[model samples]
Target: MKDDTKIVHVGRANAKRHNVVNTPVYRASTIVFEDTQQMREAMDGAVGDRKKVMFYGRKGSPTSWTLEEAMTELEEGFDTVLAPSGLGAITTALMAFLRTGDHLLMVDSVYEPTRHFCNGMLAKFGIKTTYYDPNIGEGILKLITPTTRVVFVESPGSHSFEIQDIPAIADAVHSFSDQNIVIIADNTWGTPIFHKPLKLGADISINACTKYIVGHSDVMLGSITAAKEHFPVLYDGRQQLGVAVSPDDAYLATRGLRTLGVRLNQHQENTMKVATWFSERPEVEKVMYPALPSDPNHRLWKRDFSGATGLFGIVFKQTSREAVSAMLNSVSCFSLGYSWGGYESLICPSVVSHIRTASTWRYAEPGIRLHIGLEDPEDLIADLEIALKSFNTFL
Candidate 1:
């Protein structure tokens, strides 16, 4: 499909007689089969390897397929699966690839929530997680074990903002064995436009659609997109786990994704401006954004990243957590909270220690993550200036 055509109809269909542009949402738990043979066919395989099916609402309704089709087009070589939440997608993708005795290599700078799940749940299942430095690249090969079944990467490591050498890492991980270790990337930050993880060699690209994809922050959804080789398992795992999302949610997501290109552009522009603004501040000792000129991974970022979003961190030297809070609360425009990629700006004190066991988090002070929104940069900067004043006041 052509790019524009793909955007409009890649995952959508005008299947009914009315010929509506968007897929009609069909909500159902019981699908009546006309005959015994029809019932057997419905049970055989809802969606076939060759074509789509109206097999079961659980496999996905037309509404769900519309979104999946669009997402698949955006992510080159990826077959997609939907999850109830971002973590649901994350956990489901992992479950599809890992057996009990399998080992997994993870990035140390993964989202704390993901890290928490890894520590608490994956470990209990007898799956060992070895966290490598985000910058390790092909050097990761030395750390891989025969039992390693998956390599999970969250590039520009969530709050830490460390850009990874994905192509290099992919080449190394794939050489481990024919055991076919899956390369899973949490591509939520980049979506598919800015960075095509699958095209770069990842086996799977997962997203917390709750962030940018949904745009409104009103919906909670996640997606796990798979390379052709692994699409079957992703879909199978989602099917068995009963990961069907509501049609209403799917409709909202579809609408939100239509504006993703424009929204992401604004987000990138605002984030660069905000990161630079924070970097020059005396109170901020370090800015943990890959786009920063002085960042350790700046070259890698420039080479691989088409853009960025509002999820960068700023560390204040010699400032207490209370001081950071005071400033964050003082800001008129930057509301203190979690979750990002919404139209409204948000600020939060970011804590990244769960996976910091290998390296000491020896910053002079704790850091705060900010999500710059569509607000005027000047107004946002002015609000931040006042917030800094409050920080100084607390000092």
Candidate 2:
């Protein structure tokens, strides 16, 4: 089925609840069994066949299960596990395959919180993390050690927007027969609509449902979809951690997901328009959107992705803090805030050089990340025009 059709139909099969079109919220806590034998069977099913049974409320109910089914199908994975937040998904997926003394190859442009988890928490657990260039591609094989267990990738990396050669990296990892190395890709930016990491040889795919899946900035949820060989360990890890997402949030995310394809199309169109305008501005040194033909990572993005999303970054040629602040303060349409994928536009300054351990952020100029929402491109451009004028005032 096409993505749009899958989004609308995948989870609605069991909507037989009162003949409803959507899966009704099944807020559950303590499920009771008629007898000890039934309870024993449920317990067995929870461990032996997780998808077919729900032994406890924490395990999941029809509502959350529906969302999981939809996500698993959309991601084209064996199964999926839900998390309370994006960071929860990342940390849990990492801990699933990593053991004490295990080494992790992390993309240098990974989300900052993921880096912190590796450096701060994982470090304390005796695991070592080595940051690798986002562009390493097949060269990633050279960094593999006997202790290496996982490679974490985030395409169009956080803030700087560098697209990794995912297929090349995956091939390199799989070529090494010494140890079974797992590959995890953060699919929040590429999203299920555009990129399916598992199809590209990634072992697991993660999505911060808070962003595009939730569509609105209302709910906080995450999903980890794993290939058949890796689902057991990933599921066991999440269960051991006792991670669970609210059924209400899961329902909301599912609702938001149904419209994801259409919403993302609008986001891509609007973002491309705004990003093109930024490229023509004199104050702009670069527009870090892979969709742009002029971007350094465009070839990789075009090769691997079917579409782009609302999020992208721009660098000012030479601007001060005060100048950037002035521009931010002057923007009427774009909200100066963090987080993206909502219907409303947002802008925030990013300083990534300090966070890099293996990468050199060549651009010393101030960078502004923009989430071009569903707003009309002309209005957003008009707002940016005013902001840029204010930026020039301080310069």
Best candidate according to lDDT: 2
Model 1 segments more than 4 A misplaced: 1-5, 15-17, 47-51
**For residues 208-234, what per-residue lDDT tens digits would candidate 1 score against the true structure?**
888888898899988888888899887
Residues 306-335, candidate 2, lDDT per residue (tens digit)?
999999998888978889899999998999
Candidate 2: where are CA atoms >4 Å away?
Answer: none
Error of 1 at 188 (Å): 0.7
The C-alpha TM-scores of every prediction are 0.95, 0.99
Lowest summed-lDDT stretch of 10 residues in model 2? 47-56
Q: Model 2: clashing residue pairs?
A: none
Error of 1 at 332 (Å): 1.5
